[model samples]
Target: MLIGELAEQAGTSTRMLRYYEAHGLVRPERTANGYRCYDEAELRVVREIRGLLAVGLGLDDIRPFVACLRAGNPSGDACPDSVAVLRRKLAEVDDYIDQLGAVRRQLQTQLAHAITVRPR
Candidate 1:
Protein backbone atom coordinates (compact mmCIF):
# COMPACT_ATOMS: atom_id res chain seq x y z
CA MET A 1 0.00 0.00 0.00
CA LEU A 2 0.97 3.62 -0.38
CA ILE A 3 1.45 6.11 2.44
CA GLY A 4 -2.12 7.34 2.28
CA GLU A 5 -3.59 3.86 2.46
CA LEU A 6 -1.33 2.94 5.35
CA ALA A 7 -2.30 6.10 7.20
CA GLU A 8 -5.98 5.40 6.70
CA GLN A 9 -5.65 1.85 7.91
CA ALA A 10 -3.64 2.99 10.92
CA GLY A 11 -6.17 5.73 11.75
CA THR A 12 -3.50 8.40 11.42
CA SER A 13 -2.63 11.13 8.95
CA THR A 14 -0.16 10.85 6.09
CA ARG A 15 1.74 13.76 7.56
CA MET A 16 2.28 11.80 10.77
CA LEU A 17 3.46 8.81 8.76
CA ARG A 18 5.90 11.01 6.92
CA TYR A 19 7.14 12.34 10.24
CA TYR A 20 7.69 8.79 11.45
CA GLU A 21 9.66 8.01 8.32
CA ALA A 22 11.73 11.13 8.79
CA HIS A 23 12.55 10.10 12.35
CA GLY A 24 13.79 6.67 11.16
CA LEU A 25 10.89 4.95 12.89
CA VAL A 26 9.33 3.64 9.70
CA ARG A 27 11.22 2.72 6.54
CA PRO A 28 8.96 2.81 3.51
CA GLU A 29 10.40 2.04 0.13
CA ARG A 30 10.06 4.06 -3.02
CA THR A 31 7.99 2.89 -5.92
CA ALA A 32 9.07 3.00 -9.57
CA ASN A 33 7.79 6.54 -9.82
CA GLY A 34 9.41 7.50 -6.46
CA TYR A 35 6.25 7.22 -4.42
CA ARG A 36 6.53 5.78 -0.96
CA CYS A 37 5.27 2.19 -0.58
CA TYR A 38 4.57 0.33 2.61
CA ASP A 39 3.67 -3.19 3.65
CA GLU A 40 0.46 -3.93 5.53
CA ALA A 41 2.45 -4.86 8.61
CA GLU A 42 3.35 -1.24 8.97
CA LEU A 43 -0.20 -0.50 10.05
CA ARG A 44 0.39 -2.30 13.34
CA VAL A 45 3.76 -0.66 13.78
CA VAL A 46 2.35 2.81 13.30
CA ARG A 47 -0.44 2.18 15.79
CA GLU A 48 2.06 0.88 18.32
CA ILE A 49 4.25 3.91 17.90
CA ARG A 50 1.28 6.24 18.40
CA GLY A 51 0.21 4.43 21.53
CA LEU A 52 3.69 4.73 22.99
CA LEU A 53 3.84 8.43 22.20
CA ALA A 54 0.38 9.09 23.69
CA VAL A 55 1.63 7.61 26.94
CA GLY A 56 4.54 10.14 27.10
CA LEU A 57 7.21 7.92 25.60
CA GLY A 58 9.56 9.76 23.26
CA LEU A 59 10.77 8.30 19.98
CA ASP A 60 14.21 7.62 21.42
CA ASP A 61 12.62 5.64 24.23
CA ILE A 62 10.53 3.73 21.70
CA ARG A 63 13.48 2.59 19.60
CA PRO A 64 13.99 -0.61 21.54
CA PHE A 65 10.34 -1.55 21.29
CA VAL A 66 10.42 -0.92 17.54
CA ALA A 67 13.51 -3.05 17.25
CA CYS A 68 11.78 -5.88 19.05
CA LEU A 69 8.89 -5.69 16.62
CA ARG A 70 11.25 -5.62 13.66
CA ALA A 71 12.88 -8.71 15.09
CA GLY A 72 9.57 -10.56 14.54
CA ASN A 73 8.23 -10.46 18.08
CA PRO A 74 4.47 -10.63 18.50
CA SER A 75 4.62 -7.67 20.89
CA GLY A 76 7.02 -4.73 20.75
CA ASP A 77 7.69 -4.90 24.49
CA ALA A 78 8.63 -8.59 24.37
CA CYS A 79 12.40 -8.00 24.36
CA PRO A 80 14.91 -7.31 27.10
CA ASP A 81 15.89 -4.00 25.52
CA SER A 82 12.30 -2.86 25.56
CA VAL A 83 11.96 -3.94 29.19
CA ALA A 84 15.03 -1.99 30.21
CA VAL A 85 13.76 1.12 28.46
CA LEU A 86 10.37 0.83 30.13
CA ARG A 87 11.98 0.43 33.54
CA ARG A 88 14.01 3.58 33.04
CA LYS A 89 10.93 5.50 31.92
CA LEU A 90 9.02 4.27 34.96
CA ALA A 91 11.72 5.60 37.26
CA GLU A 92 11.69 8.94 35.50
CA VAL A 93 7.94 9.21 35.87
CA ASP A 94 8.19 8.44 39.57
CA ASP A 95 10.76 11.17 40.05
CA TYR A 96 8.56 13.66 38.19
CA ILE A 97 5.60 12.78 40.41
CA ASP A 98 7.70 13.38 43.50
CA GLN A 99 8.88 16.74 42.23
CA LEU A 100 5.34 17.77 41.36
CA GLY A 101 4.13 16.71 44.79
CA ALA A 102 6.69 19.00 46.46
CA VAL A 103 5.68 21.89 44.21
CA ARG A 104 2.03 21.33 44.95
CA ARG A 105 2.65 21.38 48.69
CA GLN A 106 4.57 24.64 48.44
CA LEU A 107 1.80 26.25 46.40
CA GLN A 108 -0.81 25.15 48.94
CA THR A 109 1.23 26.58 51.83
CA GLN A 110 1.64 29.93 50.07
CA LEU A 111 -2.09 30.14 49.39
CA ALA A 112 -2.84 29.47 53.07
CA HIS A 113 -0.38 32.12 54.21
CA ALA A 114 -1.87 34.71 51.81
CA ILE A 115 -5.38 34.11 53.18
CA THR A 116 -4.23 34.40 56.81
CA VAL A 117 -2.23 37.63 56.26
CA ARG A 118 -4.86 39.48 54.14
CA PRO A 119 -6.42 42.67 55.55
CA ARG A 120 -9.95 42.32 56.90
Candidate 2:
Protein backbone atom coordinates (compact mmCIF):
# COMPACT_ATOMS: atom_id res chain seq x y z
CA MET A 1 0.00 0.00 0.00
CA LEU A 2 0.95 3.64 -0.25
CA ILE A 3 1.91 5.92 2.62
CA GLY A 4 -1.58 7.33 2.91
CA GLU A 5 -3.19 3.93 2.92
CA LEU A 6 -0.78 2.62 5.50
CA ALA A 7 -1.33 5.65 7.70
CA GLU A 8 -5.09 5.17 7.46
CA GLN A 9 -4.87 1.49 8.31
CA ALA A 10 -2.51 2.20 11.19
CA GLY A 11 -4.75 4.98 12.50
CA THR A 12 -1.90 7.45 12.36
CA SER A 13 -1.17 10.46 10.20
CA THR A 14 0.93 10.62 7.07
CA ARG A 15 3.15 13.17 8.78
CA MET A 16 3.80 10.70 11.60
CA LEU A 17 4.72 7.98 9.11
CA ARG A 18 7.12 10.40 7.45
CA TYR A 19 8.52 11.33 10.83
CA TYR A 20 9.00 7.62 11.60
CA GLU A 21 10.89 7.26 8.34
CA ALA A 22 13.06 10.26 9.17
CA HIS A 23 13.87 8.76 12.57
CA GLY A 24 14.61 5.28 11.13
CA LEU A 25 11.64 3.80 13.00
CA VAL A 26 9.85 2.48 9.91
CA ARG A 27 11.53 1.32 6.75
CA PRO A 28 9.31 1.44 3.68
CA GLU A 29 10.35 0.58 0.17
CA ARG A 30 10.73 3.19 -2.55
CA THR A 31 9.06 2.58 -5.86
CA ALA A 32 10.71 3.20 -9.18
CA ASN A 33 8.76 6.44 -9.38
CA GLY A 34 10.10 7.35 -5.89
CA TYR A 35 6.87 6.79 -4.04
CA ARG A 36 6.93 5.13 -0.64
CA CYS A 37 5.46 1.65 -0.53
CA TYR A 38 4.51 -0.11 2.68
CA ASP A 39 3.66 -3.71 3.40
CA GLU A 40 1.00 -4.98 5.80
CA ALA A 41 3.74 -5.72 8.30
CA GLU A 42 4.59 -2.06 8.32
CA LEU A 43 1.18 -1.43 9.80
CA ARG A 44 2.13 -3.51 12.82
CA VAL A 45 5.35 -1.57 13.13
CA VAL A 46 3.48 1.70 12.99
CA ARG A 47 1.09 0.49 15.70
CA GLU A 48 3.98 -0.52 17.92
CA ILE A 49 5.62 2.83 17.36
CA ARG A 50 2.40 4.64 18.15
CA GLY A 51 1.83 2.60 21.33
CA LEU A 52 5.31 3.41 22.56
CA LEU A 53 5.06 7.08 21.64
CA ALA A 54 1.71 7.35 23.43
CA VAL A 55 3.51 6.25 26.59
CA GLY A 56 6.07 9.11 26.21
CA LEU A 57 8.78 7.04 24.55
CA GLY A 58 10.87 9.02 22.08
CA LEU A 59 11.87 7.87 18.60
CA ASP A 60 15.37 7.06 19.74
CA ASP A 61 14.04 4.97 22.60
CA ILE A 62 11.86 3.02 20.16
CA ARG A 63 14.62 2.02 17.76
CA PRO A 64 15.57 -1.19 19.49
CA PHE A 65 11.98 -2.40 19.62
CA VAL A 66 11.59 -1.59 15.94
CA ALA A 67 14.72 -3.55 15.21
CA CYS A 68 13.37 -6.44 17.23
CA LEU A 69 10.15 -6.43 15.26
CA ARG A 70 12.03 -6.26 11.99
CA ALA A 71 14.09 -9.19 13.13
CA GLY A 72 10.88 -11.29 13.13
CA ASN A 73 10.08 -11.37 16.80
CA PRO A 74 6.40 -11.95 17.57
CA SER A 75 6.50 -9.00 20.00
CA GLY A 76 8.55 -5.83 19.60
CA ASP A 77 9.88 -6.00 23.14
CA ALA A 78 10.56 -9.75 23.10
CA CYS A 79 14.29 -9.31 22.60
CA PRO A 80 16.81 -8.71 25.35
CA ASP A 81 17.80 -5.30 24.07
CA SER A 82 14.20 -4.15 23.92
CA VAL A 83 13.57 -5.48 27.43
CA ALA A 84 16.54 -3.49 28.74
CA VAL A 85 15.15 -0.36 27.13
CA LEU A 86 11.81 -0.97 28.84
CA ARG A 87 13.53 -1.43 32.18
CA ARG A 88 15.40 1.83 31.80
CA LYS A 89 12.21 3.66 30.91
CA LEU A 90 10.47 2.15 33.93
CA ALA A 91 13.22 3.43 36.24
CA GLU A 92 13.06 6.88 34.69
CA VAL A 93 9.30 6.99 35.23
CA ASP A 94 9.71 5.89 38.83
CA ASP A 95 12.23 8.64 39.45
CA TYR A 96 9.91 11.17 37.86
CA ILE A 97 7.09 10.03 40.12
CA ASP A 98 9.32 10.37 43.19
CA GLN A 99 10.24 13.91 42.13
CA LEU A 100 6.61 14.76 41.62
CA GLY A 101 5.76 13.43 45.06
CA ALA A 102 8.38 15.69 46.60
CA VAL A 103 7.04 18.68 44.67
CA ARG A 104 3.51 17.87 45.88
CA ARG A 105 4.74 17.80 49.48
CA GLN A 106 6.41 21.18 49.05
CA LEU A 107 3.24 22.65 47.57
CA GLN A 108 1.19 21.32 50.48
CA THR A 109 3.59 22.85 52.98
CA GLN A 110 3.46 26.22 51.21
CA LEU A 111 -0.34 26.14 51.24
CA ALA A 112 -0.40 25.35 54.94
CA HIS A 113 2.10 28.11 55.74
CA ALA A 114 0.08 30.67 53.77
CA ILE A 115 -3.11 29.61 55.57
CA THR A 116 -1.48 30.11 58.98
CA VAL A 117 0.19 33.44 58.11
CA ARG A 118 -2.44 35.14 55.99
CA PRO A 119 -2.69 38.95 56.33
CA ARG A 120 -5.96 40.31 57.71
Candidate 3:
Protein backbone atom coordinates (compact mmCIF):
# COMPACT_ATOMS: atom_id res chain seq x y z
CA MET A 1 0.00 0.00 0.00
CA LEU A 2 0.94 3.62 -0.24
CA ILE A 3 1.81 5.97 2.65
CA GLY A 4 -1.73 7.29 2.95
CA GLU A 5 -3.16 3.79 3.06
CA LEU A 6 -0.71 2.76 5.73
CA ALA A 7 -1.47 5.84 7.78
CA GLU A 8 -5.22 5.22 7.55
CA GLN A 9 -4.87 1.58 8.50
CA ALA A 10 -2.51 2.44 11.35
CA GLY A 11 -4.87 5.23 12.58
CA THR A 12 -2.03 7.70 12.54
CA SER A 13 -1.22 10.74 10.47
CA THR A 14 1.06 10.56 7.46
CA ARG A 15 3.21 13.23 9.05
CA MET A 16 3.86 10.96 12.03
CA LEU A 17 4.73 8.13 9.67
CA ARG A 18 7.24 10.38 7.95
CA TYR A 19 8.62 11.38 11.33
CA TYR A 20 9.00 7.72 12.19
CA GLU A 21 10.80 7.17 8.92
CA ALA A 22 13.06 10.11 9.61
CA HIS A 23 13.84 8.73 13.05
CA GLY A 24 14.71 5.33 11.54
CA LEU A 25 11.84 3.62 13.25
CA VAL A 26 10.06 2.49 10.10
CA ARG A 27 11.50 2.09 6.63
CA PRO A 28 9.34 1.97 3.53
CA GLU A 29 10.68 1.02 0.17
CA ARG A 30 10.72 3.54 -2.67
CA THR A 31 9.36 2.97 -6.12
CA ALA A 32 11.30 3.78 -9.27
CA ASN A 33 9.36 7.05 -9.38
CA GLY A 34 10.51 7.80 -5.78
CA TYR A 35 7.17 7.21 -4.12
CA ARG A 36 7.16 5.33 -0.84
CA CYS A 37 5.82 1.80 -0.94
CA TYR A 38 4.92 0.06 2.26
CA ASP A 39 4.13 -3.58 2.81
CA GLU A 40 1.60 -5.08 5.20
CA ALA A 41 4.32 -5.67 7.78
CA GLU A 42 4.85 -1.92 8.08
CA LEU A 43 1.31 -1.53 9.40
CA ARG A 44 2.19 -3.60 12.43
CA VAL A 45 5.41 -1.64 12.88
CA VAL A 46 3.55 1.65 12.81
CA ARG A 47 1.02 0.42 15.38
CA GLU A 48 3.81 -0.70 17.67
CA ILE A 49 5.52 2.65 17.40
CA ARG A 50 2.29 4.50 18.20
CA GLY A 51 1.59 2.27 21.18
CA LEU A 52 5.07 2.88 22.60
CA LEU A 53 4.77 6.62 22.07
CA ALA A 54 1.43 6.60 23.93
CA VAL A 55 3.27 5.18 26.91
CA GLY A 56 5.69 8.13 26.92
CA LEU A 57 8.56 6.44 25.08
CA GLY A 58 10.53 8.76 22.86
CA LEU A 59 11.70 7.79 19.38
CA ASP A 60 15.20 6.98 20.59
CA ASP A 61 13.87 4.74 23.36
CA ILE A 62 11.50 3.09 20.88
CA ARG A 63 14.26 1.99 18.48
CA PRO A 64 14.92 -1.29 20.26
CA PHE A 65 11.27 -2.24 20.18
CA VAL A 66 11.09 -1.58 16.44
CA ALA A 67 14.25 -3.61 15.95
CA CYS A 68 12.71 -6.44 17.93
CA LEU A 69 9.63 -6.43 15.75
CA ARG A 70 11.76 -6.38 12.60
CA ALA A 71 13.60 -9.42 13.90
CA GLY A 72 10.43 -11.51 13.39
CA ASN A 73 9.43 -11.70 17.03
CA PRO A 74 5.70 -11.94 17.76
CA SER A 75 6.01 -8.99 20.13
CA GLY A 76 8.30 -6.00 20.27
CA ASP A 77 9.14 -6.36 23.94
CA ALA A 78 10.20 -9.97 23.40
CA CYS A 79 13.85 -9.02 22.94
CA PRO A 80 16.35 -8.34 25.72
CA ASP A 81 17.06 -4.80 24.54
CA SER A 82 13.40 -3.87 24.55
CA VAL A 83 12.97 -5.41 27.97
CA ALA A 84 15.93 -3.40 29.24
CA VAL A 85 14.34 -0.20 27.97
CA LEU A 86 11.07 -1.13 29.67
CA ARG A 87 12.88 -1.73 32.94
CA ARG A 88 14.62 1.62 32.76
CA LYS A 89 11.34 3.42 32.02
CA LEU A 90 9.65 1.64 34.90
CA ALA A 91 12.43 2.73 37.25
CA GLU A 92 12.06 6.32 36.14
CA VAL A 93 8.31 6.18 36.77
CA ASP A 94 8.90 4.75 40.20
CA ASP A 95 11.31 7.54 41.08
CA TYR A 96 8.81 10.14 39.92
CA ILE A 97 6.11 8.53 42.07
CA ASP A 98 8.38 8.68 45.09
CA GLN A 99 9.12 12.36 44.45
CA LEU A 100 5.40 13.12 44.17
CA GLY A 101 4.73 11.27 47.41
CA ALA A 102 7.33 13.39 49.19
CA VAL A 103 5.75 16.56 47.82
CA ARG A 104 2.32 15.43 48.97
CA ARG A 105 3.63 14.83 52.48
CA GLN A 106 5.20 18.24 52.59
CA LEU A 107 1.97 19.85 51.42
CA GLN A 108 -0.01 18.01 54.03
CA THR A 109 2.31 19.20 56.80
CA GLN A 110 2.10 22.78 55.60
CA LEU A 111 -1.68 22.62 55.48
CA ALA A 112 -1.84 21.23 59.00
CA HIS A 113 0.48 23.93 60.32
CA ALA A 114 -1.48 26.70 58.64
CA ILE A 115 -4.77 25.46 60.09
CA THR A 116 -3.35 25.21 63.61
CA VAL A 117 -1.83 28.76 63.53
CA ARG A 118 -4.74 30.59 61.86
CA PRO A 119 -6.27 33.50 63.79
CA ARG A 120 -9.51 32.64 65.60
Candidate 4:
Protein backbone atom coordinates (compact mmCIF):
# COMPACT_ATOMS: atom_id res chain seq x y z
CA MET A 1 0.00 0.00 0.00
CA LEU A 2 0.89 3.69 -0.20
CA ILE A 3 1.12 6.41 2.43
CA GLY A 4 -2.42 7.66 1.93
CA GLU A 5 -3.87 4.18 2.08
CA LEU A 6 -1.94 3.39 5.25
CA ALA A 7 -3.16 6.60 6.87
CA GLU A 8 -6.77 5.95 5.90
CA GLN A 9 -6.71 2.34 7.06
CA ALA A 10 -4.95 3.26 10.30
CA GLY A 11 -7.41 6.10 11.00
CA THR A 12 -4.62 8.67 11.13
CA SER A 13 -3.55 11.51 8.89
CA THR A 14 -0.97 11.26 6.14
CA ARG A 15 0.77 14.21 7.73
CA MET A 16 1.15 12.23 10.96
CA LEU A 17 2.56 9.28 9.05
CA ARG A 18 5.04 11.59 7.42
CA TYR A 19 5.85 13.05 10.81
CA TYR A 20 6.45 9.55 12.12
CA GLU A 21 8.79 8.92 9.24
CA ALA A 22 10.63 12.17 9.87
CA HIS A 23 11.01 11.22 13.53
CA GLY A 24 12.47 7.84 12.45
CA LEU A 25 9.53 5.91 13.83
CA VAL A 26 8.17 4.71 10.53
CA ARG A 27 10.41 4.18 7.55
CA PRO A 28 8.79 3.83 4.15
CA GLU A 29 10.68 3.29 0.95
CA ARG A 30 10.66 5.76 -1.91
CA THR A 31 9.44 4.93 -5.35
CA ALA A 32 11.41 5.63 -8.50
CA ASN A 33 9.63 8.95 -8.82
CA GLY A 34 10.27 9.79 -5.14
CA TYR A 35 6.80 8.92 -3.89
CA ARG A 36 6.59 7.18 -0.55
CA CYS A 37 5.90 3.47 -0.60
CA TYR A 38 4.80 1.45 2.43
CA ASP A 39 4.66 -2.23 3.11
CA GLU A 40 1.49 -3.96 4.36
CA ALA A 41 3.19 -4.58 7.71
CA GLU A 42 3.48 -0.85 8.14
CA LEU A 43 -0.23 -0.74 8.81
CA ARG A 44 0.32 -2.54 12.11
CA VAL A 45 3.26 -0.32 12.93
CA VAL A 46 1.32 2.87 12.29
CA ARG A 47 -1.55 1.70 14.43
CA GLU A 48 0.87 0.91 17.25
CA ILE A 49 2.35 4.38 17.04
CA ARG A 50 -1.08 5.98 17.11
CA GLY A 51 -2.14 3.98 20.15
CA LEU A 52 0.99 4.95 22.07
CA LEU A 53 0.53 8.64 21.23
CA ALA A 54 -3.10 8.52 22.31
CA VAL A 55 -1.95 7.28 25.72
CA GLY A 56 0.41 10.26 26.16
CA LEU A 57 3.60 8.51 25.08
CA GLY A 58 5.96 10.74 23.14
CA LEU A 59 7.70 9.61 19.95
CA ASP A 60 10.94 9.10 21.86
CA ASP A 61 9.24 6.79 24.31
CA ILE A 62 7.56 4.94 21.45
CA ARG A 63 10.80 4.21 19.63
CA PRO A 64 11.56 0.98 21.41
CA PHE A 65 8.09 -0.40 20.79
CA VAL A 66 8.37 0.35 17.08
CA ALA A 67 11.79 -1.27 17.01
CA CYS A 68 10.34 -4.31 18.73
CA LEU A 69 7.67 -4.67 16.08
CA ARG A 70 10.22 -4.17 13.34
CA ALA A 71 12.29 -6.94 14.92
CA GLY A 72 9.50 -9.42 14.05
CA ASN A 73 7.67 -9.40 17.38
CA PRO A 74 3.93 -9.92 17.16
CA SER A 75 3.34 -7.10 19.66
CA GLY A 76 5.27 -3.89 20.21
CA ASP A 77 5.51 -4.38 23.97
CA ALA A 78 7.15 -7.76 23.62
CA CYS A 79 10.67 -6.40 24.12
CA PRO A 80 12.41 -5.49 27.38
CA ASP A 81 12.82 -1.85 26.46
CA SER A 82 9.16 -1.56 25.61
CA VAL A 83 8.27 -3.18 28.93
CA ALA A 84 10.44 -0.66 30.78
CA VAL A 85 8.67 2.20 29.08
CA LEU A 86 5.30 0.76 30.02
CA ARG A 87 6.36 0.35 33.63
CA ARG A 88 7.58 3.93 33.78
CA LYS A 89 4.40 5.22 32.23
CA LEU A 90 2.32 3.24 34.69
CA ALA A 91 4.23 4.78 37.60
CA GLU A 92 3.64 8.25 36.22
CA VAL A 93 -0.05 7.58 35.93
CA ASP A 94 -0.16 6.33 39.49
CA ASP A 95 1.46 9.51 40.74
CA TYR A 96 -1.05 11.59 38.80
CA ILE A 97 -3.91 9.63 40.33
CA ASP A 98 -2.52 10.27 43.78
CA GLN A 99 -2.34 14.00 43.13
CA LEU A 100 -5.89 14.02 41.86
CA GLY A 101 -7.07 12.17 44.93
CA ALA A 102 -5.46 14.78 47.18
CA VAL A 103 -7.11 17.56 45.23
CA ARG A 104 -10.47 15.84 45.48
CA ARG A 105 -10.16 15.54 49.23
CA GLN A 106 -9.37 19.24 49.56
CA LEU A 107 -12.37 20.20 47.46
CA GLN A 108 -14.67 17.96 49.44
CA THR A 109 -13.48 19.48 52.72
CA GLN A 110 -14.07 23.02 51.44
CA LEU A 111 -17.53 22.10 50.17
CA ALA A 112 -18.50 20.66 53.55
CA HIS A 113 -17.29 23.78 55.41
CA ALA A 114 -19.14 26.11 52.99
CA ILE A 115 -22.35 24.12 53.31
CA THR A 116 -22.21 24.19 57.11
CA VAL A 117 -21.44 27.92 57.35
CA ARG A 118 -23.86 29.11 54.62
CA PRO A 119 -26.87 26.96 55.42
CA ARG A 120 -29.96 28.34 53.55
What are the RMSDs of all candidates, in order? 1.4, 1.3, 0.9, 1.1
Scored by TM-score, the top model is 4
lDDT for 47 in candidate 3 is: 96
Residues 35-116, candidate 4, lDDT per residue (tens digit)?
Answer: 8999977888999999999999999999999999999999999999999999999999999999999999999999999989
Writing each residue's lDDT as its tens digit, candidate 2 over 1-120 gives: 999999999998999899999888888999999999999789999999999999998888898988999999999999998899899999999999999999999999999999999999
TM-score of each: 0.90, 0.92, 0.95, 0.96
TM-score of 4: 0.96
Candidate 1 vs 3: which has more TM-score: 3
Instruction: Itemize residue pairs with steric clashes in candidate 3.
Output: none
Candidate 4 stretches greater than 4 Å from native: none
| Residue lDDT tens for model 1, 80-110 | 9999988998999999999999999999999
- Model 3, 1-120: lDDT tens digits are 999999999999999999999888889999999989999889989999999999999999999998999999999999999999999999999999999999999999999999999988
Q: Arrange candidates by TM-score, highest first: which order?
A: 4, 3, 2, 1
| Candidate 4: residue 90 lDDT (0-100) | 98
Clashes of each: 0, 0, 0, 0
Off by over 4 Å in 1: none
